[model samples]
Target: MLAESIVIIGVNHKTAPVAVREKLAFSGDCAGPLLTLMDIDGCRECCFLSTCNRVEVIFVASDPAVAAVAVRGFLFAKSGLGDAEAQQYSYLYQGKEAVAHLYNVAASLDSMVVGEPQILGQLKQAYRDAVEQKTTGVILNRLLHKSFSVAKRVRTETNIGGSAVSISYAAVQLAKKIFGSLQDKAVLLVGAGEMAELAAEHLVRQGIGRVIVANRTLERAAKLARKFNGTAVGLAELTTQLAEVDILVSSTGATDLILRKDEVKPLMRQRKNRPLFLIDIAVPRDLDPEINDLDNVYLYDIDDLKNVVDVNKAEREKEALRAEGIVAEEVVKFGLWLEGMELAPTITAIRQKANAIREVEVAKTLGIMKSLTENERRSVEMLANAIVNKLLHEPMIFLKNSTPHDNPQLKLAFIRQMFGLDKESPEQQPPRENV
Candidate 1:
């Protein structure tokens, strides 16, 4: 049988909003059962990756067009989305395009915030989960490993991740501009949101002296606080915590201002003119814009962080061009391998056809000439084998080096036709033992 084509079906941050991506996301416990349900003859292998920004299902299938539809339907059932809703957000890619998309994703070029370092880890975990579930076979095993190498090459060969490109990372960069280093600073994380968590992670990595996590729900704050060895507080206690911290980062779902100028003015006075740095990463603006004018206080909103991200994005886009070239090269190389795989059996069939003919002809000749010496018979057999090998040499080399674009399947069909190899039963051309 021929090697399967790859198919990818899913929704990402670009194709769908967070609401849609969340609806499609699969947890580890759900992956095993889903893999079992998706198990079918057409799709030979599968892997699923789900993160905050994207949910993707990849497969190696006999017919990618059919498999793409099936996979999309499977995800739709899992998402509980109506026909109209599902159709609006789903995206699909087939064959080499699907493979290239996976390569780009592993390399982080497909991320909402390009060059973010988290997606690769997520991909690795997904690959492991699929492996553990036995959802992946040889083809995907090779492809996923190649993706890892491709990601490493993109990282080493390009500066795509050299600077801070994410909004949370940009917040960290802005903080460094004022404090030189965050080692001795106290950070008050004012929400347990993803952005706040990411910003807090950066702060911990920067060696912040203390971290205080506050949220409307103290339990949510406590959960995030445990991850970074930080203290948890309720939003009601924000006034007292604000006075103790040097930096405040807020990214919440609340529609109203979480911190206003009136709320912060007294905190600044208690600090004896000490500077306070504020970052509000929420949509609808968590911090009052009026607070930017306060004495000894600096406030940077989401828009300011995005401006920093814009600059970093421009630089990363330059690096992405180089990475694209690398992906294209790898895609062609993998395509050639898949093509060469399909043509290999035909090469074996022809060689077996030639060898069988030689064996019959040689035996008949030796049997009729009974007086011939054993040494003469040996010479004849050797000459027959040499001739068969010489005749097959060029064709074997050509098949091994050929690609899918060479119309390899057509070439194989023609080879079988020309040599009358089609008359032989598949049992006659059963795989020859490797020498």
Candidate 2:
């Protein structure tokens, strides 16, 4: 069974620390990784998904164990970690487990903040990239498409997403806690990417007094700022703007820290030692960890947002249980489809055997009745075919209706024996050409 070897191997926030996850996170397009995975010995079809909190490779492999080892090595190649260490930090799910895991991801039930909707879009983009690169085939195409539909079913049927709290939303909730009310607070967003946009959206909803977006690209920053009717500035003016804004959200893609403690210490004096709330949601961490040490300055990284998320998770957890049930139902449906696929060859073999027997009998009868009219001979052949179909129809239905409790291999073996399909003696069987 091709789907029996379907596997997902990677690290997420639950299994690996942010420091480790950041090392394996693929930044740009997925073309490079997809091609590399296809180059591996047993990898057949694959999709590469890298997000801020997790990096996963979902693939079908002819040799699962060997391919899994190679994939884990590839993922941790840039992390300077050996296979043992990488294996320690990573997780692997195979077969039906892999299908269920993907569905959970699509439904956001496995997210750092369960029910966050962003992961679904990210998964969809990864799938599209895999499709464009021709890295996905029939199995993955069906599996991934099913995952999307399952996610939609969960969203439509449950209120999981309705009460969802994202990392950005959690960050904003923390800011509101520290400042008491956002109505009088000015926020300085250090990056204008999706995370920053999410934070800004939540802040505006909280009725924050002002919003300031700062980015490496002024045009992009200005674009996002305009959406919120806020102000935009370049990265250089970060320290300058720190004096005016009470809350700062940094989610840039910088490889190094964009704001150091030394750079921010003097700014506190300029702001008259006012309390500053800094949220660093970037994976590599755009803000310095030491910045938290400064007087009247509070800093929270991505992991800190988890604590805030946990506070309001009870309702979402209940909704998540409902979503999990939906995922389980979809998983079983897909499993049945895969099992039916496994039955296809057996079904074909049975039909061929029945046709072969009918053909040999019809040929012998026609040979015996040489004086019969051509129309009469055709009628005899048609009658033989009709009898074969009628005899096999019930058996075909029984095969197709295989249940989870039924051992498919046993059922197939029984049918093969019952029909004498296992007999291969030349004297007992018609020649290939004659049949």
Please tell me which predicted candidate would have the highest TM-score against the true structure.
Answer: 1
State TM-scores per candidate.
Answer: 0.58, 0.55
What candidate 1 gets wrong by more than 4 Å, as runs, is 1-4, 79-88, 174-201, 211-307, 343-435
Please provide, for model 1 over 1-435, each residue's C-alpha lDDT reduced to its tens digit, 9 standing for 90 to 100.
Answer: 344477788788899887777766576564664466357557777898878788788887777767776677777776787766776898887778887999999999998867778899999998898888888876787789889888987887899998887787787877887887789899999889988888888888888889999998999999999999989999999889888898999888899988889988988889897788999888988899999999978999988888888889899999999999999998887776556445656777787789899999999988898887889989989998999899888877876676656745456655666777545233223256552
| lDDT tens digits by residue: candidate 2, 1-435 | 756789999899999999998888688878999999999998988999999988999998889999999999899989999999998999999999999999999999999878889899999999999999999876788799889988988887898876426577777767766888889889998888998888889889989999989999999999999999988898899888998899998888889999899998998999899899999999999999999999999999988887666655877888889999899998988886566445787788789988888989999999999998989999999999899999999999988897888755557656766877545344334237531
Superposed Cα deviation of residue 312, candidate 2 (Å): 4.8
lDDT over C-alpha atoms for residue 139 of model 2: 74
- Model 2: pairs clashing at backbone N, Cα or C within 3 Å: none
lDDT of each: 0.81, 0.87
After superposition on all C-alphas, the RMSD of every candidate to the true structure, in Å, is: 13.0, 16.7
lDDT of 2: 0.87
Candidate 1: give the clashing pairs. Answer: none
